[model samples]
Target: MLHATGSKKELTRLAYYALVSDILEHADVQALKQFRHHRYTTRFQHSLNVSYYNYLLCRFFHWDAVSAARAGLLHDLYFYETNAYDRTESPGQKSHSAHHPEVAVQNAVDRFALNPLERDMIEKHMWPVTHRMPQYKESYAITFVDKYAAIVEFFGLGAQRMLSHIRRKQTV
Candidate 1:
């Protein structure tokens, strides 16, 4: 990663290494490549979107950009297999969405040797909306950004499909 200018360079370095290491350890390259090449809406893209939103929120709040980006990127570590939802669900049962975050937190801690703050951010990113309320300011920042990104991704998927439908109609 390029060196970020100004105050939090050291902290950013620490967070960046830990988070990237965690991602590499957990994410399968074949799966990621298949998702990217097959045009699947993927955890990788989701993570990137979350990271971007976290950057925006961090800048707005004067938080550590590196830490925020790391937290966002690593928040969905257990989502290496995009079909997890399909595997866990049986016919009528609702999605097992709530479990992934805890699974992710555990995997991240074990894989990356995360510090307390980094762990907190990964663990609490689903706050208010999914999990319990976040305690730390960093956790709160992740929570805010995660939710915002989710909404944006939701609308983005809709827009993409809408445009595809329009193009299909024109072709026909």
Candidate 2:
């Protein structure tokens, strides 16, 4: 069942799906399924969690929830395996945190015509860790949502795995 962090609602059945259905259908977004995030979750799932919670938060605040959701979905949209690159502190060489957003923005722009708010949110979701401050309110919303979703995806999925293992053992 597809659900977001801290919520049990099935995402597709909810109103939130309307905002991201096209982006979700794209080949580039689907490619995230191959990348692991936070150890226990796929980048696709992590992105979905970020997207959903971001949408909810932005909607509550009366911000641009559509942009928030789209940006969240595309924020980490890079292809390389997570640990494959040797991230370095060398000047002019980008760390993984600094680099992936640019790649994601480029990839997203190629497939979707993003507004400035969406662009800012995707580019600055890493916030102070990245070079610029997020210019849009929705952008700031995503930074928190991204981190929140990661923690939940990491520990929540780990717990789920443990429960599943226990269930299997009990069945035996």
Candidate 3:
């Protein structure tokens, strides 16, 4: 229903603007731009992509778009260099996928007045890897969108191409 009056691109842009308009100017959120995420993408870029995708899905399903967008944007708020982790290390000093969610949740809570849904979404985006299911629909949307964004970033797709690719995948 929401997309009926506008092109997907237009709708996505609107949703993206709604997600970032207030948070973009926040110093801590802006600092995310400096951290590297998947491949060559910055943490800010990846977060934006995830938030946008989550926003689209939330709008499509008539879910909590604001909460999904906010949680998606902060899902990877952990500030350390993720690439430094050694795969061979023990559980206590391993890859980021297992630990960053908790750290990110803590950081987000410290910086933002997050609702329970947002906190759950941020803390459980890792899903089966973390063994905790999302307690809210928006949280599930964020989890899926986060994975979608990660795959896109891993493949080095540009913004326009990423949207197109995601659209194509949605159809299949």
- Top model by TM-score, which number? 2
Model 3 residue 20 lDDT score: 57
Cα lDDT tens digits, model 3, 66-152, are: 888788778888776776654555756735776889999999989888999889999989887788888888887787888877876
Comparing 2 with 3 on lDDT, the higher-scoring candidate is 2
TM-scores of the candidates are 0.68, 0.89, 0.78
Q: 1 or 2: which has the higher lDDT?
A: 2
Model 1 spans > 4 angstroms off: 1-40, 79-95, 129-131
Q: Which residue ranges in model 3 land beyond 4 Å of their true spot?
A: 1-16, 92-94, 156-172
lDDT of 2 at 165: 99
Comparing 2 with 3 on TM-score, the higher-scoring candidate is 2
lDDT of 2 by residue, 9-83 (tens): 988898889889998878989989999998998899899989988998999999999888888899998888868
Backbone clashes, each candidate: 0, 0, 0
Query: How many residue pairs of model 1 clash at the backbone?
Result: 0
lDDT of 1 by residue, 1-172 (tens): 3222112344335544454544534544213323431133456556655665676578678876667776676787663454656576777663445556787788666656576777788877866444566666878888776766666556666577779999999999
User: What's the CA error at residue 134 for candidate 2, in Å?
Assistant: 0.8
